[model samples]
Target chain A: MSEAVDAFNIMVYRQLKRFVRAKSRLFGSIVNPLIWMVFFGLGWSSLFKGSMAKALFGGYSYLDFLAPGVVMMTVFMGGFISGVTVLWDKEFGFLKELLVAPASRTAGMAGRAFGDALVATIQGALILAAIIPLARDINPGGIPVTLAAALLTGFAFTSLGITIALKISSMEGFHIIVNFIMMPLLFLSGAFFPIDPLPEWMKVLAYLNPLTYSVDLARISMLGSGSMNPLIDTVVLAASSLILIGSAALLFREATID
Target chain B: MDAIVAENLTKRFGELVAVDHVSFKVKQGEIFGFLGPNGAGKTTTISMLITLRKPDEGEAWVAGLSVAKKPAEIRRRIGVVFQDPSVDRELTGWENLWIHGVIYGVPKNSLRRRIRSLMEFVDLWEKKDTPVKHYSGGMVRRLEIARALIHEPEILFLDEPTLGLDPQTRAKIWDYIEDIRRREGTTIFLTTHYMDEAERLCDRVAIIDHGRIVALDTPENLIRRLGGDVVYLHSSSDRLEELASMLSETGLASDYKIIDGKLMLSVRDASKAMPEIFEAARKLGVKISEISYKRPSLGDVFLHYTGRSLRDSEGSWKETARIVVRRRR
Candidate 1:
């Protein structure tokens, strides 16, 4: 078991090392969300300056309202991007090395997910740092709480990415699904708009989206305002991510050895 | 005791039999070569023995552990350098080795020492800190060889370790491989269609064709099947048969045949036979294009056993593997 843990750590370290060395991916993840925050947020804020829009943000400026949402976006993207890398490894033959290693594939998969989650979480935290200079409404003490929420959110998507990528044989197939799935999850998660104002059917879908919970949790922690209570939101997110990550591990075991 | 053993191991992808009733054994500390034509099940066989894929039929044992029942155990005992390059190009040589050592459960205290020795062994110690992307093809292969031995596995499997390398780099890689075998006495199993590589590195070569082991023996024994001292005589002479008959009538040569537009003769002694053959050609007024007598090689052995030269299978494994995968999909 200890040996497996060691192997797990090694696998995680490999992913982290790769993520760090890439350098561009780190800066790359930040640029997209930063643009959304600066241009989209300012543009949308002016439009929302009307009475009909102020309540949607709870009187917080559009930048202040969108900052936490942007952090969650970073976490979401980082996790999935990390998960998609297994396909690269599979194509290039590194996964074979991991599979042939004495360690458990579950441990290896878990380590892979963890490395991605850690990188994603760090990226999320960097966004928070960037946001802090612009958005004064963020609670200083709630930074750790919001970061934890980002980490959990990253794990859930990272696990989902691993689970889906494990079943998908080709990297092209994975990219299609990622591109297809990423937009709906982000747009519907109440990141840019209010879930309450959405149509009943869309609201149901928004509630079903895991990113909604992640965004809600991070947004509430940072802004001290949200649709759901922090405790309940965190509990549901934690439960679902655990289940997703657990099943991801199981799927990884089946895919690797069999 | 044998370091590895396989009994009637077979794997089928639907109707295509990738490996059929394949059985072989490698004695401890011997360098065994698996030689075959394209898509002849060499990688499939290696995959089975290294515990990457389970055989659909029969059993294999590596380092005394059953591959079927104790795959993890088997995996722990063996190291493999895959046909495709497996190094992390982004990581430095030192980082790649460190990650491999950690995955293999090497202790923290000895990990640095082991990495140092392995780096030095492959003569990459000076460039240990350089990213693998910056390393040359020969350097990457050497790094992979060292990575495979990081855990001190009982067996090391190399799949076409020098596939695209130049002759000089190939020789350098072989030197490192030989150094490993000499110093560690690890049983090395490699797959190659290159006859000379097998001749130079292998104690026993197993030649497979169409998912079956056609011949298994030492290089000398395989070549001996061709019989007699070999002579290469490329003749453009129109009366080639007449010249061959004239040479044979002299009783200087025993057996001869026209292979690939070249007249190949096997004689008891070429030193005494070459002059007589040249005199006969001169008397017949035959035009000999190119003639050179040399000892038999593994290429001859492959030809004698399989009726096809190793050159015929060159650069086909990749295409074959791609087809196999496409068919599987």
Candidate 2:
């Protein structure tokens, strides 16, 4: 049992160390989410100062409403991009090394998911740190809970990402496939805008999206502008995170060297 | 007890049989070599033994545990250096070794001690902190060898370990392997198509051809089984092949072969057979332009069994021969 734990910790340690080693890769991946936050936050500035804005935003600014969304986007993109490492490992033949090791593949998968999610959470945390001072009515102590929610969501997304990347053999194929699915998952998750005024069909997609619940959970904790009960939102995200992680582990056990 | 055993092991992909009913055994602390050309089932057999691929028909045992029933136990006792580079290039050399040790459940102090000794043994101690990506090809291979030993496994499996390295580097890698064998008495199971690599590093070699063991013995024994000497005959004759059959019928030579535009005849005494050989050539109107004799090599055994050179078309000869035989039936 201790050996299994050691395997998990070492795999996660390897990922984190590589993450620190390749600053350019980390920097390149976060660039897109940074652009989304800056452009959208500036474009919608000064629109939430009146009492009419209070009803719409629950006494928070548009920038604050979009802060959690943008942070989730960072974590979301970070998690999604993490799966490319598996493809890279497969291409470079390092996956064979890990598979032949005495440790369990499930342990490696769990550790990888943990490491990528934590690294993604760092991006989410950095975005929050940058936007918190510029925004108003922020709770300093609530940051940990919000980050935990974001990490759980990140783990869920990264697990799903690995599942898809397992079937894809090339980096170029993964990029094309992720772009097609990610944009739709992001836009329909009520990320850039609330789902209040969307068409009936679009609302259902937003409701079904696990990303919507994750972002909503963070918004409630960070901005207190949530549309649903925080408990229900947290429960849904946590349960699905477990489900996705379990599924990822199952698929990982069957991963062949071929 | 045999350190490793495969009983009627078989693996197939669609219509192609990658490893067909192959069985073998490896004794403890022995160097076992599986020699074959590309696509001759060497990799498939190693994969099955190491539990990387499951056998379709039979079973394998490593360290006295059935591979199909207890793969984890076999994996725990074995170390593998793949034909491809399997080290994490992003990690430092020391870090790669450390991760392997940790995963194998090597205790901290023992792991540290083995890492120190193995790194020094492989001459990679100075580059332990360098990321593996910057290391040259030989350095990465040496570092991988060090990593595979960090866990102190009983049996080591190396697949084409010296495929693309320079000759000097290849010799250096073999020196490290020899050092390991002398110090730990670890049994090594390596697969390679390079004839000399099997001759140089292995105690016993199994020559696999078309998913079967065509020959298995010490290099000297297999070569001796071919003949004492190999006579190379290069002649000018439009009917050289017909000349070969004529010579065989005239009690001059049997099992003559044409390879690389030269007629090779395995002779027990080349000097004693020279008179008859020249007379047979004279009768067939084929002049022996150049003739030389040398001690037989593993190459002769390979040709003797498969009737083709290792460098002959990669897996094509086997396919063509199989098709012709099938049509003949």
**TM-score winner:** 1
User: Candidate 2 falls in which docking quality class?
Assistant: medium
The alpha-carbon lDDT assigned to residue B210 of candidate 2 equals 75
TM-scores of chain A in all candidate models: 0.95, 0.92
lDDT of each: 0.84, 0.83
lDDT of 1 at A231: 85
The ten-residue window of minimal lDDT in model 1 chain B covers B313-322
Q: For residues B1-329, what per-residue lDDT tens digits would candidate 1 score against the true structure?
A: 99999899999877678799999999999999998766889889998898778899999889988998898787778889988878888899999999888888889889899999999989999999898989998899899999999999889999998899999999988888788889999999999988778878899989887678999999767766666577788877777777777777777677778766688788766887888888888988887888888766656666777787777755455656766678534
Each model's total of backbone clashes: 0, 0
Q: Which ranges in model 2 have alpha carbons more than 4 Å from their true place? A: A44-59, B228-300, B309-329
On lDDT, the leading prediction is 1
The residue pairs that clash in candidate 2, if any, are none
lDDT, candidate 1, A91-198, per-residue tens:
867777777887877777778788788889999998888878877889988889988998888888998888777777776786687768878889899888779878
